[model samples]
Target: MMKKPNTAQTILSVASCKMTRAILRKTGRGGTAIPGIVAMKAAKNILAAVSEGMEIVVVTGTNGKTTSCNMIEHALTSGGHECLLNKSGANMLHGMAADLIAAADWLGKPQYPYAVLECDEAALKLVVPYIRPKVIVVTNLFSDQVDRYGGVQNVLQEIRTGVERSPESVLVLNADEPLSASLARSTPNKVVWYGLEASVGTQGNVDLADAGACPECGGEYAYDYHTYAHLGGFRCPRCGYRRKDPDVAVISVDKKGTDGSTIHLQCDGVIQKVRISLPAVYNIYNAAAAIAATKALGLPAQEAIDSLSSVQSSFGRLETFSLNGNRVQMILVKNPAGCNQAFSYVTGTGEDYSAVLCLNNRTGDGHDISWIESADYEKLCADPHLKKIYAAGDCREELYARLRKAGASEERMERVSDYHALVEQLKEEGHPVFLLPNYTSMMELRQAMTQATGNREFWE
Candidate 1:
């Protein structure tokens, strides 16, 4: 049970936060985190107070956090449960505080029965201590925001800290990810592992693996097969750490196309054919994660699988739009692995599409442009269906240089610095447009495209 605050300070804090949010919204500012910051500063225990009596699920990882959270939220809502979420992609402590405060009344009482939070990996340590979620879903870990996280080990430690704090929370982990699977050994929390079974096919050869060395013994791990980016059937020769059988496994893939996929999902010995509306192997992993999470919440596996069939791409991830009679698909790429996935998706579509690569070196997007080299840009350039490539964003020059180095033809390359101009140019292109943007650049591109198309703003 949540401890209600009877103090006048608590009341004043909640009132001030609410008022600030309202004022910001009215003034055409999307102040997503300010209210929570103000509330937390005014009353330190505000999140705890409001989060009481709600079943909270915290989703955190290097990638797929947003999509996974969206899937879980969709499942919960479709199952007739009112849920709260930080929909503005605010996953930090201040942002989370703001979200919870916004969902509560003036007295910091929650109106919803559930809160599905997309949490930043570092922010997990801060949030889990206070909210103590009923379930913590770790999608997977990879090198991301290198300037902020320093290294993948640091990220693992941060998530481990959060897990340790929430001893009672059920953990939905990825068995194929050695780092994620290792978390089960550290914390006393009950863990439910989910991953692709061997029948789904092996990951293609890549020059690098994020988790090449075993976390347990610091020895090079061997793999029976790989899905992508160091996720698959792995075994540490030195420490005997091996992949565990998943509670929710993808037993077979019936069909995989540009639109979606059909797979056989086996949960607790029961198998069912599930359709994932989103394309890509990464999304299949996301579907497995969502199914495991829903099961952890005591929801039927079929309910979650059904919700996945209708799950639309969240925010800028594989979001499609019809602009001026031309199709535009926006995919958010923050790291090499994610970028490679997008590249594969675009080229595999078998359509002649114009591609826009937006790069930004803002702090939010790690300043390390070097990771772009790891993406299979050469393969993307080799695709004959990729008609033309447009470079945009603050780091357009860098992107152009990278494209050239990747063997992209100079005749087909152009630079569009202004997002509005880029959108206009894309509108004129007769073929479909695939836009890939980094973190900050994604927000800018989405805003420009949405404003021109009259689509609802992200905050809405």
Candidate 2:
């Protein structure tokens, strides 16, 4: 039998939020179990008192939590305010607690002027009471982790409970996402909605992957233009329900190839332009959401914009690395809509590269890989530069079968059982590997790579 970790060592090690976050992510067992156990025990002896006049901001979404949290923290820190943050994609109850405990002084005092945390939707219900965030930012609600969350509605309700508990907190929502926009409907708090202008997208039949119905009326919502899957300008036909005119709106978006995007927005009556390093319309909204929430906390618009432009991809979300002399991208794909956005963004450019689609049956990535079938594999497989396909992980066979059903030829595919072996093979071939990994599989693969390369820098 394996021995449990030491209680004091675990708690003390978690003091550096960054180090604790990496330990939890690289500890294995689905990144949601052991660290959580340690955190639950750690929080018992580490209760903290909120400093006077300090603000607490909590950011949550199916995707973009890490990047959003990083941006928010960067803005606050750049503006000369001390910030306690979880920038390593640790968002569960234990991870959140570990971040807080790590941020605490030696005497267990929270010395920061503000705290910004990214929260896992399911974990929010359990941690919100302990953290009592004064500002809650809802990025977007998407179908992810069906096994743990049950479904999208359940995840929404879980986050809603957290938001309702801090009913006095400033609720900043994505006006583009129906579920996120509907969060403050019954709550008695300052609700501020944010979004992008309809003119930014092509004015036609907006291409949407899923969730086009109104959350309030279950009515078919009409879209002025869809910037990305299930996100854009939409209004309900039956109840006259529509996108709330945002207090902060992304008025324009200009793409700059791989460098990033420059977004012009009207935030709190101020017209400001923010440039972000990540591509895709989704990231624009992520930057916009961060700006809106931070603005409410009195952070300057220019500082927020500057911090956003300097941000990089958080781990597997789009973290690019040099592979075989070519820049390879890692865009996480789990559900239908997210897969579609990643697919659309990559394929929309008409550039092609080899791909490694790693899927797993781990708890954090959803034990059932049935959701992968809902993804648009046909479109993904047909891209011209897709030189090869590599599948590995707990559900490798299942993903292999799915790709075969999608008409992938045997000559174009390979399945390696070991992650380290796969990395070695990729390095030998010298071709860019566009890794499409599910949650835990991605972390496991990275852990293996980090160990093999002896480089903690890339893993960060």
Candidate 3:
């Protein structure tokens, strides 16, 4: 049982956070991290006080954190457990603290039995000490927010520090992700790994491989097969460190299309055919990570597997809406790895479609926009089904230039600076539409598109 905070400072912090959150919600500002910041200022230990007595599962990685966390939450709920989550994509310390504080009562007592938090990779170090989660899931490590994290290795170290802080927590990791798998060596936590055992398809060329070198030694790593980027069966010849056989492994992908995929998964020697409601190979990894985490929490594996079939796409990741009798899908892409996967999914559909590329160099998206160049835009250009290409957002010009360089026709390219005008134009087009946007741009464009298309707001 968790006790309420009676200290004067703690009591003051609780009041401040509750009052600020209420005011912000009423003002249409949206409940963000502001209240958490106020609470932390009033009482530095507010997070520790509010998050007590809950089984916490923190999901952190370069990509797939949000989707994976949502999957875990869905699985938990399907199994009849009440859980709280930070679904706003606010994974930093202040935002995390805010969500925890908001989920608690005035006395600073938790309102749920579990918390499935999607934490930022760098912010993990700050959050782990306070929450002391029962399970920590690292989806995968890719070169993301390079300007902020400095490099992929730095991001790995940050996550490693977080795992070290929660020594008693079980570490659930992606076995195919070499950098993520390496974290198990540095932490004494009981580690459970999940990855694909069978090949999904041919490994295509990518512009960058963040995990080319072994973390233990400078020797180049070898891969027996690669699903995408640096994730696969990798082994370092010098240090002899390699991917461990996953406790929960994806044995084969039976049928995969733009709608969803049917896969054969092996969890602890029990193989089951599962259907993941989401598309793309990356989502398969997300499903495996969620199942691994749920199993680690001592939940029924069958319930977790059953829940995957009904899981809807999160905020901006492959979320679809209907506009003017045409279907519009929004796929969030933050880095080259994610962008390439989105490209593959769109092209794989084999249906004629127009594309909208949105890029923003906002603070949340890491001011550096050079990483966009690393994405395989040529794949999109080569697709005969690709009809028209529209570029939007603050970095629209950059995206147009890249598309042209990849062989996009100048006559088919147009720039739409205004999101409203973009949405209106999209309505005029009679073909299926695919919208690709980076972090901040996704938020802005999603709001506009949802409003124009009569879709539910993210907060709803």
Candidate 4:
């Protein structure tokens, strides 16, 4: 049997690994890739470091993992709890180890009072056993990274396994996801479900992320209302299984893009208004999930709401910036579900808009742009507010072809292979440019923007 590493040895191993990552991070070469590989080895080296009852919380899903995790961390800290997080958007084993290493005390102990991790679905299958978190949050399951994960069900099963294995942990789920909601029904762990409800100003029509089928009986599901995606009031027709009323719900949501909101929320009937800077109804859902998780931790509803409105996007999740006298909004789009929500947010406002859509096929971006076709491109092309579409990054031709099918004029589409060139073109135009970029493309453009303008806002 392999001997567990000692504290000094473990610290040394982590230090060495982080040093290597630091060197890579400085190279202008995609060094963030190494964290995924190094995290597992670091975990092995630090096998003896973790103790029981550590209060570790892990957040995972195709979308909202980063945003949700960020909210959790913020709330936890707001309650005066020290927490450790993989803030670099790592999610894999090596990246997780790096985060732990960075947060460790001088004595090689992780000084944070609690641990919160955002785990990639496939990575969670391997890392959960090692970490054994006290809380696991599955944000939502959708057809994400099909090239890497095969299918949504496959990733769902992997997450189910992770939650099942950690029976002692609390499972926080997106009750609207058919698979995630069903897992809550069968899992041995204590389960907490969060979802939106039908109401005025909410989506009456389902967005593409809607999973509108019964996971148990393959029966059709009914919706009282539809939020951006498959989330909202839902019930399976055959099994009569329905979306449970959420313990926490955003009762009244008022958002003005680039502006903020006064969100009225109710936690099991207690109501309060939350002041938040993040715009978009999708963010309200994100906030609702965070509030639910905090309530699960036993904090008062008002406390969660107070902290939630103060939280900001960690990076490229609805982060806004001023660039070339224009308000630039960056929304990360990796899967069809997320892409659809993004498209809806931009087009629904009925404001004339121009956008720079960046795509990349790197391992981080999943090498499969085919899912872009599955997105609701018709929302963009048919919207009278949309003026121009500039496609950049890998597979621009494919993206152009797909957008064309949805009514985008061939004359309005401009393809640019370089990030710098795209930014220059964006600067020449004075309209708000909604930048939709996948993982790697976001980072590439982030670096270019940082170099040219000394601002991280363009990528944030």
Candidate 5:
């Protein structure tokens, strides 16, 4: 429980958040995380104070949090319900605090009845208790930012710690992911499950052979099929710990490459054919997650499923735009799981396109670029439809070496170090261009590309 802050502390906290955000915007900086940091420094319980009485749903995990939150928010808004959401991809404690404070009144009380907060997996414990959300959604976990979180098991424990902190918050878990599904056993919280029942594909260069094991017993898992990565139907021979029958499940999927996918979804014994505008098998999981979460939050299943067809949340991941008279899709790849999915989706599409692979070893992108070796770059390089592979970023040499080793021909590959030069080369491409960049490199290249194309800033 948070201490009862004095009236002065409450006022100061709210003012601090609002003012800091304003200054950040004026100074041409991102106000997402800083304002929350400033506000929390002013009042420790300010987040709880403002969020009190507001119904909330907190989304966390290594992937799909933002998309799931966006879908839930879209469903809520489609039903004429206004809600607060942290849609700027700031899932940390401070970023969430800033969002809440900005939405609350001057006295530190929320002005709305609901909120959909995307909390980072590691930051989940920090924000979950204060919000005590109505629902907590955990998308599948993978090895992301290995230096900061250590490993996948460590990331799982961090999320489990967060979920354990607030047992009153109902959990919406990916039933197919044994690692994330194990949370249901540790916590007393009610679990709402979602995942794909069948594999969209099983072909890839990545080795996930040792990835999913029984969390209860030190036993290996046998999968009936895989939707993506290590997620699918799995049963442990020793402990009998296995995948749960999901409350909302993707019964089947008809993928349309980058255009989108049509999924047959099952909700409360009723099957609904839903069309998702987002591409890839990972997005099918994201859709299932959204439907499960919104349904748990009391929205009609039809409304929740219907809302996804119109949600255009490609704020970076698989976002496409016209640049230099070419159609360029920007997909952010930070971890092997995400990178493999991106590669599989593109290569599987059979589309004639060129690719620009951007690699950066900054803190946000994780200082380890060696993880690219784990990603299935072979699938991407082997695509006969690939007109060329232009390696760009600070680590372009490393990317060039990696792709060359993955069967990319010497004559077909090029290395462009400068962003300006990369943009110019993209102008000459007749085929659709696929731009895959890590976190920091995405930010850097996006600035140049968006400027050249007259697109709005990421924050806008």
Candidate 6:
């Protein structure tokens, strides 16, 4: 157990956070992580001190962490339960500490009993030891920011080290992903599994990641069916390792399209039809994870299932905006699997649309943009629904090179550095639009889109 701080220490810590946050707001820059750093410097273990008696649920993984966390938070709040979260999508230790600190009174007393934190996969070990959460959710894992973590194996190790620290915490693991599902053996922690039992009918890209190698034994395996990249029923040829029965599973994806999906789900033994407002089958994985996590937190499975229908898009993840009389949907693409899924959503229907693809190597966007080579833009190029494919950001040459290889003609693609010019063209064209940008590019472009479409809005 952590030693509680004295009254004097609490005052100093809270004061430090307040002063630092005020200065950041005044400067209009760097408000998320700095304040918590300063506060922790003043009083060590400030996250533990502020969250002394709170119930925390930490969601960590490469792709679905934010979406899964948002779904859990929505269910909690929609059911008349007040809770706090790191609204800025900051999953680092310092950002979460700042959020918890802000939620506390001057004496470092928590105002809410429930807190949901989105933690970075590598940082999960660091944050979980302090928060000692009631439940930890690991959405599917994949190679993310290879420049930072090196590979998926390294990230998997980081999460295991953290879970090892909290052996008593119940973990909600993705049953189909060997990288994530392998966590079940890392510790004595109780595990609740959730995943898609089969494909949602569109996971047919032959380029799916080679999840055939068993994480335990380095032997090749075979898949019964593929839902998406590296996810499905699997059994190792050498070792007996295989996918287990998921507690909360997507038994069948009843319907899916550009707008959204309707899936038949079996939640902790009860069968229910879940209509998720988000598009793509990846979100089906997210909804299942949310339901499992919420149930572990003592929420009724039905309430969590009911809340899935209303979970709105978080920040730049599949957010829709309106510009002059046109509707535009923005999807954040980080890796090959996620990028390919976005392509499927944009061209899933027969409706023609214009799109802008941005690539950047800014620190926030990962210094490596070579991942684009792994992403298939051929679908977008061949689709009859494509009007114009605009390439933006630092790596247009490389992006264009890949597009050319994918058969995109020079006449079919245009270059745009000025986001305002891109918006003006969209307004004139009056066709539906799709915005695909990485981390930094998304921030830069979403700023312009939000500024132009301030009043007119459409809910997806």
Judged by lDDT, which candidate is best? 3
CA lDDT, every model vs. true structure? 0.85, 0.71, 0.87, 0.72, 0.83, 0.82
On the 0 to 100 scale, the lDDT of residue 441 in model 2 is 84
In angstroms, the error of model 1 at 161 is 0.8
Sort all candidates by TM-score, best to worst: 3, 1, 5, 6, 4, 2
Which of the two candidates, 4 or 6, achieves a greater lDDT against the reference? 6
Instruction: Give the alpha carbon lDDT tens digit for every residue of 38-68 in model 1.
Output: 8877888788887888999999998899889
- Give the runs in model 1 whose Cα sits over 4 Å from its true position: 1-4, 199-204
- Over the stretch 323-405, how does candidate 3's per-residue lDDT look in tens digits? 98888999999898898888988988879999999999999899999998888898889899999999888999999999999
C-alpha root-mean-square deviation, each candidate: 1.7, 5.3, 1.8, 2.9, 1.6, 2.3
* Candidates 4 and 6 compared by TM-score, better number: 6
Superposition error at 417 for model 6 (Å): 0.8
Clashes of each: 2, 1, 0, 6, 0, 0
TM-score of each: 0.96, 0.86, 0.97, 0.91, 0.96, 0.95
- For model 3, give the 10-residue run with minimal summed lDDT: 1-10
lDDT string, candidate 6, 139-190, tens digits: 9788778998888888888999989988878999999887888889758998
As for candidate 3, its clashing pairs are none
Predictions ranked by lDDT, top down?
3, 1, 5, 6, 4, 2
Which residue pairs in candidate 4 collide? 35-95, 38-94, 39-93, 39-94, 40-94, 210-230
